[model samples]
Target: MIRQRITATTDPAAVHPGLAEHQSDMIRRCPYLGPSVDRGLTVWSAYDAEPGDQPGLFALLVETAEELRTARRESGPLACRNIAILDPEDSESARKIMQWPAWLARNLYAPVQLMVGRFWTGVELDDSKGRAMMPPPVSFFSLRNAIPSKDGLFLSEKLPEIMAILEQGPGDDGRDVFAEPLGRRVDDPASVYRELKGLFPPPSLATAG
Candidate 1:
């Protein structure tokens, strides 16, 4: 099971800029239903952050969903700005960098859909498709690459291939399949692999074959 560690409940006026004045009252009156469905945004600590310096990064995974009809209809990368929360030049800075097109799309055109990666959420999905969709945790080292778009990000990679498979209907069939437990953020990949092996002992040769 997965558990949420944080919640946002501030007035729309105080946080979200898109909420209109008329909607503010309605949003306020509406019960605080909690963060928007735990869309895979989480606090991630760097492998070597010092004590008390936990949660070194704020990660938001964009995942393909059935509800993303407009995104599904599109053939290429959906444009969006990579909002760097920190300085862009610094290696450790959290600044999100959006290429000219993505910046323009977010600032000039309508907002596009982004998908969330389920592996990082620490919640296991019950079905094979959902499980197959999980990517190697190391892949997140390039967080921006997971963002699928045709527009091309300034310095980010788009994930159209990953998205296409995930978007398939439940009854759909294909050669695409994968099986691996979600991995943890650690100092090295070898250590993580070792830990996973212990949790999931290798199947016998007959079973594996």
Candidate 2:
């Protein structure tokens, strides 16, 4: 768990070097999370912010990407995963969290995948693209009131699972099982983001109707 602790940060740059430059395009692609993701692409109090789970989540994924980067260096090529973690529909507070997949891609430049019933576990660590990549399993460890600051999002209980996955790396025997009852696979976060924006629409627009 040292990785999780030490890696934890409220900074966007800490996760990836390209964060700032691509942030605008990312926001444009996933405008639903535009304001939240556009917190200037700098460090901030992600843990304490309301709906506050953004930064911490960023940190974890940042570390995960680092691990994959390392694996790629050591092992020839790497596949990336692009997964989305949809918040429970009833949860207005957690709703925006769903856009995180797009934000992560903009920053990490990796694909994300989701394993249904697994909360939001999605990934794409594969060699299909002939590049070093990892399965995009977006595991969403549920936190009933997990609003980032609530600290519920970072419960110790789920650390082991995350750590285990980190240790397993990509293309493991246990992956298929872990990915049981798969949900959606988001190849194009931008298009998906636009589609979602239309399907869900803004609260302001919904009310006007």
Every model's TM-score: 0.23, 0.26
Cα lDDT of model 2 by residue, 65-174, tens digit? 44444433444222222222333223343334534532332212211221111122223322222343332222232111011222223322433333233333343222
Q: What TM value does model 2 have? A: 0.26
Model 2: runs farther than 4 Å from truth?
1-50, 78-95, 108-209
Evaluate all candidate structures by whole-model CA lDDT and list the values in order: 0.24, 0.30
Candidate 2 lDDT score relative to the true structure: 0.30
lDDT of 1 by residue, 13-118 (tens): 2222332242233223322212221322211211222122112221121111222323334422321111112122233221122121122112111122233321
Off by over 4 Å in 1: 1-6, 16-92, 96-114, 117-157, 169-209
| Poorest 10 consecutive residues by lDDT, candidate 2 | 142-151
How many residue pairs clash per model?
13, 43
